[model samples]
Target: MKQANSGALVVFGLVLIAGLGGALLARGALYLGMHEGDTLHLLDMALRMGLHGQWPHLDFMTPIGILAIAPIAGLVAMGLGIGTAILWAQVLVALVLLLPLVRMAGSRFGGLWSYVMLGYGVVLCLALVHGLANPAPSVSMHYNRWAWAIVYVVLPLALLPDRGRARPYLDGALIGLGVGALVLIKVTYAAALGPGILVALLVRREWRVLVVAVVAGCAVLAVMTALGGSGFWVAYLTDLLTVAQSETRPAPGGIDFADAVAGPANMPSSILALAVVVLLRMTGRKAEGLALLVLAPGLFYVTWQNFGNDPQWLLLLGAAVFALLRTDQPDSRHAGRLHDAMKIAGVAALALTASSAVNIAYSPIRHLFAEAGNTVPLLSALAGQDDIRVAEKRLYKVDAGVPLDGVGQPFAAYHDRADRKELSRLKGEVLPACELSTGYNAMFETIAADLEAQGHAGSAVLTADLLGSLWMFGDLKPLKGGAPWYYGGAPGLAAADLVVVPLCPTTEKSRATILAALEKSGWRFDELRRTDVYILLRPVRP
Candidate 1:
């Protein structure tokens, strides 16, 4: 009891430090890197839910589980500005996971490992940058980070023997809650880790834990269903399937699954994981070894499927190595040699993944020091959100590229070899093969202002591009049934009053895909207005 209590105290101290740092970040403006588009997507969804009393899958189309944005939305609902809400949401997640972290870490981990378990928990919850080592501090895919923290908490509880007396109910509840949280945050993580977790409990004969996890998961589902109504499940699944079947983003960021698993950058981590599995098996811990083996493929899939495909799994793998090292299996043979090998593997795993872990840990500090003079407010019309800023160059510089394929152009000579194809024809109007590379912040604000000027201030817009975020900038309503970020299908089309087609879209493929879907659906539009920037059309509703 003393040990657990002392360890819990250490966790609180670490969490308090992170909490103070998060408050500082909330006070200062945030400067994001390489993910303004994703940031905007999150901000838009959060605002839709917060300001409009809306819900995902009911009011909008998205595969992302509500828990991803609900905490931030909850903060926004409580009258905090968007910028502060985002920062504080991280702190809130860390605080929410405190009980599980303390319980799991204190009961299972010893000395340095106990501190490590709790410390990483705080990092995962309060991290300003989504961890991959290329840290410039941005709040994007933060749910993934939160899910990982829950994974860390649950993993040790399921895998290791408790240092103290067994408390299956407490352990079971934590496991169940963690898994349920994962399901509600992002089902992909839950799907990936589910089998391994179940297998671990089954192999270890932790039937109580297994039953409790399932019941708790179902309870979470029941609670959400009651809140969002029974239709929520069907709509949520539909949105997920739509994204899964999307032709535009078959694998996020065009990642090669094989490469992500065994490529030069990730090969070492893969090898280290396999070695640990073999070492564990040889030392009379086949169940632990087997669970890790099952976890390996899921880990790889998640790394590849996520945008940027950062190998954040390495930290988890490192934790696994240390946890196994701390355990004693009396029936083991060749224990000395294999245990030494395990120590080497643990060190190697942590060393390889150290940069990413360090980067995530330091992000709040990095965000606190971002220069304000060189940046402008992220949203132009959001009155009190000046605390979220973007670099002037990223926000205001308009740049687009169209392939050179004219009668007299140099590329015309090699047209056959160029693999050139005209994009999509929208209502018999051919869109050029053009892409808007920068100035998205400007694009949304400009279109919103223009639409408001033309007496379309409060209309719901469905952009024929990758994003439909004009509502964030001016007097427009977020489409009642829109996808914050397009993932195939005409999600918000029927609910939209107008369609804004940018001349140079952020993603040409998305533009072409959306237009093709519209054409197949036989949707017709009346040209309301046209300008150098966009074509505004009113959909002829059935």
Candidate 2:
């Protein structure tokens, strides 16, 4: 008993070191490799929530739950530099989750498996980059990483029986807090795995676990409600429905639901899961088999819902498959085959997910080297802080897009042959058939400076761009009730004094979508001015 306890402590100690050391390796700075737009979106929301004391859903609009940005916002509110706040917030989150991780990992796993499970949680918490093995580092969809970490901590406790003693209270409470955190971080995760967790506990007759998890989850909800109010939930649901119903909000990189499940990239893990489910049932591990049967679709759903469609669940699935092997009966002749098959499946699953796992674990090490490139500060608003920097080319290089043939060309008959979506129109005004790419920080800072120079400083501006982050760049006041990223609707129109319409947007369809929604909502506006940069309009009382 002493040896095992000490082993768990050693594994946890390694996890703590890996987490804190990795974060501190950045030297209190955050260097981003890609996804400046997404980073700007996060910073905009954090400043709004922190400096302006805005509440998500109440004072602004976003599908992302407040908890996703609140910790960083709180730190920024305390006058911490944004990049420093991000790194330390990660450290804070790791420390906060350490106990839950200890309870879950210590109770359920033994040997190296404990390290794999808990270390992965630390990686999810502390990694500077969001997962996609080969891609450059980014903080984009970081909440998804956090949500997956919570899922890791929860599902293990829910599915696996304890190694030493079954303390249902500790397990259930942790599971509850995890799921609750998932809901508050990214609702898609909870919506994905919450049912499977409940059923797994039910099938195992772990009534205490189930009841306590429900109570704990509700306790989290109650606390959030007491802090924000019931309307917060309604607004959260509204934001979710907006995304669910919007055609533009599908999984990015053109990955649809079927693609997430059966696409070339996902096929291996999907096959491994199916084979393992069959093997688990064949080996008389019916409860776990049923759980996986239910879990596979949920995993696919979350992958499809997330921006990158990363199959991060594969590692956990692989871990669970290996763990299930220990539960098999020794008498069956097929036990040998089941063990062999589980081993192969588990190993293959891990192999498939290995690149991304390694990528996540190696992010901070990569961050240290990211400074080798010619870099510039991420935002001029936080300029001179020098804590957040990006590659020079990613900011200065702009891609405004190439148009198809004009009136007298070969493809002229095709008429604006772009991608899948058509060029958008707003209130009978056709937007240009072009899109902006890269140069997010440069673009926002330039436009914000121009607006300030034109005597619009401190004015609340609503931008008909993919992100409403003009406030992040200059003296403009943060939109009191606007979305940082447009997920549809005229989100902050009520608080917007001027609407700035970009001719060439980073995401043309999204820009068109927002403009159309604002027009459709009957927002009365008078065209104030037009420039090479943008068309400005002032909202008028109808």
Candidate 3:
């Protein structure tokens, strides 16, 4: 017994180190590569709330959860730069979410195979971290991966037959917490998993466990709702309905079973294979059968929601491999064949993951670390100096030499080295503006200057192409309550003194609508400036 305890401790330490180390390494790599995208905007909004006590409106269209952004906000409030704050927050989250799984795996497998299971967990963490930094079609920083990881961790424990007397309570609490967190992060995802978990509990007839889980989950929801206020509920429900009704938004669709079973990553095929293994095990192993049965509904939900890009499928693959590898009766012919098939599927999944990683070689871990040795010092030097005007002037001078792309350009491509002079320039002048500009520094500055010259700097400016840039660069507030898209059919058009619409192929319809509205309102329109990208417009005198 003493030896078993010691072995568990050793494995725990190793797994903790690997998981935490991998997370931090991934964070550092992403930071060095200057990889910022969708999530950063969410973080920015959270930071504003935390730092300035400015909460987003209840009707705000974006659907990010408050809990996911809160930690980043907390980190930033503690005087960490945004990059450093995000790094630490992500690492902490990864550890919190993964450590329980390691403990459970070690407790169940209890040997070298236990170590392999923990290693598998570490790889998944690394894969998620990689996705966060360099998002691809198959892997990205989305809620689904995290939700599925929790599912993978909880389902095994839920299915284990010999969890002892106290384990049901503990497992129930853990599931409650995990699912609660997922619920706060994404309610729709929570809705998907909830039915499966409830049905599983009912099948097992674990009334006490079900009660504990339900109570704990409700408590979490109540607390979060209290903190977020009543407005948050309104916002959440509104967003949910809006997303469901909107044709532009991606909605969950029915899964093609044949396609899933023959998918390239072997995820779907492995799941089907695992189902067969579970049935075979039922002949002699009731515990394994029950476990698979409990896990089946959630797994099916994940497979159905698999839109070919989500990394959640990998979690399913990992779970199947773990089950196959750990199943006893290795000498049985059926078991041996099942094990072999699982091995092949596991190898295929690993290969596909490796291929995806290689395809994003631009943000390789080694390169990021090596480059960080140069960039970190510069980042340090620029810290603690927050002067917006100096940064704006520098941004105005630093041109990209080409017109701005709607999607921001990569910062690394623009500034390769953090030489002392370059660092000083960034620190004393441009860094503040660069942070806000998001690769649109030069263009935003030009537009802002033109707006100022035309006496419309502080006006509620309506922009077609430059959405956030109007406020971020030109000190112009958006004319409408929501995003620019809302302004297309918005009631008050004549209220806006200046309207800047890019006369491009993409904006032709919107531009025509604005023109028609202007003509209808008896407000004469004159072109203020015509650039290759935008046609700035202003109202003529009545």
Candidate 4:
């Protein structure tokens, strides 16, 4: 018992060091400005709940689950400023994910190989940092990254050597918890893993495990619905069924079997899966090998559907390699051949993993190293600020008090506000800056001033862009039913007395549709203000 406890402590310490080191590296490489669409939306909802006692209504059109938002809410409730809370939460989650990988590696491969496995896991995670640290408004955002990590963690437990001897109930409960958590994050993504998990359990004849997983998954759904309110189910189901069917949302294209197997993102996983098959065959574990073969296609489909080029999917490959190599079987007549084959396969997978990490993280890593000297002062100056600002022609600042900047403003603003604090301190801040093509800050300032001039202060206002930023920055009331883009423009626009539009080509079609709707409803709109990039409109006497 004492020896086992000591071994566990040593493994924990090694994992802790590796996880923290990798997290720090990721922070340096990939951490920068917060993403507007998803990250900001989560932060906005959490802030609203914490600061003003408001719960996000189900009427809003978004795929983000309650679990995703809950962490930020809890952090903010603890009196941590939103910016600090978000950064710390992201770092902590990354570290927690490393724990299981470390344990599995230590148990299976003692000595330096345990640390090698840890390095492999970190590299896999580094590939994902691009999306997690600096997300975009695409369908696969941070939640998708979380789903990928969860799948990596859960899938390997089946291949662990001690599975047969483990407590049936404990093992079942753990599997159930993993699957349930994934479901709570995103059901569609979970769908990809659910079938494979069910099949694996069936192949193993682990009926207890299957039953526990189903019951736990259902309980999770029920609890989530209850916490999010009765309307949560209605809104969640409606959005899932409707928005997913909408033509405007980009859908994954079909891939030929060859491309699916050979795509950059899919290649490593394919190779690793093949390696697992060979390893299992040599060890005479036919049942496990067959179960893995069944799982390979589903996992590939999930990766292909999300983003085929992202190296993050390679983590699945790493998980497969770790699982197959870690078994505790004694040496056999085939052991020499098996060890040689495993080494070659493992080395190839690691090389690919490293290449992918470099491909995805190169820019951020370069930027971080290039500006390392200025990081401390920059962070000190901007700490606790979340409002977006531009400085030194090299960075776009967020008011969250973090002195981080990115390459450019990817979205437009609905109104221009001029009361921004122009500081000399920002003039020399060295960071990666985001160039704004259109004068969004100026446009937003003008809109805010114009709205106040028109006696529209405190009134619910609708916007086609920057809905959360506008409300939070201008101290305006939340638009009833949430942002039009999320809730469908017609309903949110109908509930507001004023609507702000940014007339970019990307928005032209949606703008035209909204205008036609207003005309059909016998509502006349007067243009309140116009800029090169934005136009503010108000309902006028019909």
**Candidate with best lDDT:** 1
RMSD in angstroms, all models?
2.1, 2.3, 10.9, 10.3
Q: What's model 3's overall lDDT?
A: 0.49
TM-score each candidate: 0.95, 0.94, 0.66, 0.70
Q: Which regions of candidate 1 deviate over 4 angstroms? A: 1-26, 326-333
Residue-wise lDDT of candidate 1 within 1-542, one digit each (tens)?
12356545565646565665564465455677668888889988999989888998888988888999999999989988888888878877877777778887788776667777777877888877777778676888888888888988888888777778788888888888888888788888888878888888888899888888888888888898888888998888888899899987788847688988888877888888888888888777889888888878887788787877777777666766766673465545655667788888888988988888998887777677766667788888877766677789988898888778656787787767777666677877787678988899788888998999999988999998888777888889889888789989777889889988888999988888888887787778889999988999888864
- Candidate 4 lDDT, 456-492, residue by residue in tens: 7786676654333355545366665654244233445
Model 3 pairs whose backbones collide: none
Off by over 4 Å in 2: 1-3, 6-11, 18-26, 327-331, 383-386, 408-410, 416-422
Model 1 quality (TM-score): 0.95
Worst lDDT window (10 residues) for model 1?
1-10
Could you tell me the TM-score of candidate 4? 0.70
> The CA-based lDDT of model 1 is what?
0.81
In terms of lDDT, the poorest run of 10 residues in model 3 is 423-432
